[model samples]
Target: MRAFACPHCSSLVHFENSVCLNCGSEISYSRPDRAFVLTSTGRQCANLERAGCNWLVTGDGELCDCCALTRTRPADDDADGLAAFALTEAAKRRLLFQIDDLDLPLAGRREDPVGGLAFDLLSSAHEQVVTGHESGIVTLDLAEGDAGHREQMRVQLAEPYRTLLGHLRHETGHWYWEVLVDRAARNEGFRALFGDERASYADAVERHYSSEPPAGWADAYVSAYATMHPWEDWAETFAHYLHVRDTSQTASAFGISVHGPALESEPEESEKDFDALIETWLPLTAALNAVNRSMGLDDLYPFVLAPAVLDKLRFVHDLVVARPAYVPAG
Candidate 1:
């Protein structure tokens, strides 16, 4: 994420800040300007009363673009569910910000009822909610917002790292499959890189759960879960791409640099170049892991990027950069 400052006091502020701490100014994000503005007159999102969403309403509706994408949410009266919903919405805002930064197209169900993006933040306390994406809608179990619950599931699933933001990034990868990859021009290349997504998804799920991933799975896939299906493989790889880009951007904003004779290459400002991104990422992660170790914490990034995984990442990078220009149908 880019550094944000209070428009009034020029003091550093966070994206989630509604009231600037430095100058006691109210702040709301402006979608068109892509920055937080001091707002006394601008209307706040309708969700502000319930969800504490601070994004400004850009049009006739009271909901902001991010809040409008939420088609279903937990009951307002359910205290626990409402708490979880707030955290989930915060992560959703971060994900949407990154997508906007990448210039990715975002259309909601109202725009394309058949295959536009939408979200269902459900509470598993009442119903058994499985987190996954269907068509263009992504469902997330609000229980995942609880850090303890998330950690328990992470251990059960044998995942190295898992979080609300990671879930959003991974699931959106599925939504983008329809938006970016299913077209005629990209299908052949996508199939070659990620394998045939037409392969039986049901069978793959059964096999993946009934048994263990094949030996050396890491050599070919980003995670064992990714070995379940080509669709998952694409999503896992795409999530990693977003992870790298966002973390790298943060590092650049902080003026963090790795300087040594061993690393002679000069750093660049933009992360669009995959090689440059990977170059900055490896050394940065190494240092990060060391820092975590000193603090008696788990490695910040526990997985390694194999050569095959790198190739898949490159494919995703090229796809995003070369995304076709959107042309609305008449």
Candidate 2:
């Protein structure tokens, strides 16, 4: 997410900030303006206090656009679940911000019950709650909000990175596949890059857990998990696209135009330049990885985008740019 400044004191604020630290003035995100403003002037979401939501409402609605997408959440009696729900909602808002930036179509369950996006933020305490997307409804296992549990799952799954936002972005990919590719009748183009999605998903998941990914999987797939199925490949690639876009914008917002033998240069709207963004992604991530190494941590971005991966990324980029630019409502 791009950095923000306090509307009251000009102090650097963050996307989730509800109160200005310097001026002590309440602030909230105005979706149409895409900036922080005084809470009194803001179209405050009804969930601002209940869910720790910092976003402003977009229509004449009680809930903000992002919060309205949630169809089900933990009950009030579930204290532990409520805590996790807050963190998950925060991540979901960030995902929606990036989606708007990409100019992708978005609608709440009430807008289109059959295929419009919705979320079920379920707690895994009482029962197993798997994180996946189906029929435009994304289900998240609330345990993912616990740092220790997330770390354990990352290690167990051999994933290089895992975060609440990561889960949100990855699952949103599945939702977009239906909206952007399936509903648009662009499956032929999708198949050329992501393979056929007609394969048995059940069998694919079963086979994936039954053994290791084939050798040389990275040559084509963005991640080892992507080799499991065409659907997974699309999701992983789509999620990676978001990672690159958001991080690239963050770097630009911070004036982070740094690379080996290259630093302190101005970013030229990198997100709009797909080729330039891809070009900068590697070197920028390399510098980030080096910084992490200096701090005795693993690489920030462990995977490499091979030529084939780049091709798939280009396809995603094309699909995103195919949409008209997002213009704030009047």
Candidate 3:
């Protein structure tokens, strides 16, 4: 994610800001353009029904580009109102930023005849009028919004890092491979690295849960669960790609030296090679970890980058920059 500014007053704005803190301007994100644009009549998102959302839909007036992903909303009786919804919406916006930036195809419910991509942000299952839906749709227990609750869940999951952004990035990674990777052209190289994705997913998960992750797993795997199945391996690697790219770009903008083409002053390494990314990222992560230690926090990046992992990163880089085999919208 790159930095965004308040188009109205040029005040720096975060990916999730509904209103600018500096000039009090309203903000809207254009999905098509993959950017946040300002609106004239800025108002709290809570007033959407009465005052309308400042963010325009992809085209105009029909389905605000941001809300187009929604197939269901929380019940009117649900307490938080639009405040919590806005947070979920904002996370989706950031996810879409990656989608548009990489030209990833959207495979929504409309696209799939049966089990397709869909979303539903609702209250928990404790509600009275229960809907018997659960699978393909991502169920974000709205209660997860509480920082304390999220932190506890993070600890419970034994995850190094967990955040709304991280969840969105990881889940979207799953959706991407399901829709993007072409089976016919799935090179032997891909299978060799990630394993045979065609294997039974349920069996793999059962085995993964039953046994402990092998020792020295970090030597090659991006994450522990990534060793379970090829699909997981792909998703884990994909999420890391977003993590590195966004963090590196942000550092570049902020003039925090890590190691890049200009930073190295080495014409050879700076030639937009994968090594350039690593050169900047390694030093930057080291400095970041040191700062975290100063404040008694865990290392920001806890994983090591082995040669095999670098190969995965190179694959992702090529995938992003490669020309797509265009399939006309039907």
- Count of clashing residue pairs in every prediction: 0, 0, 3
lDDT of 3 by residue, 259-322 (tens): 4444332213242466777888888899899999999999999878888888887876666655
- Backbone clash pairs for candidate 2 read none
The model with the greater TM-score, 1 or 2, is 1
Model 1 scores a TM of 0.95
RMSD of each: 2.9, 3.4, 4.7
Q: Which ten residues in a row have the lowest lDDT in candidate 3?
A: 262-271
Give the alpha carbon lDDT tens digit for every residue of 11-130 in model 2. Answer: 999898899988889999988877899988957898876789998887887999999999889998899999999999999989988887666888767777677789999998988888
User: What order do you get sorting by TM-score, best first?
Assistant: 1, 2, 3
Error of 3 at 59 (Å): 2.7
Residue pairs whose backbone atoms clash in candidate 1: none
Model 1 CA lDDT for position 185: 51
TM-score of each: 0.95, 0.93, 0.81
Off by over 4 Å in 2: 260-270, 324-330
- lDDT of each residue in 39-95, candidate 1, tens digit only: 775788988768778899887887999999999998768999999999999999999
Q: Which stretches of candidate 1 lie over 4 Å from their true place?
A: 260-269, 326-330
Better of 1 and 3 by lDDT: 1
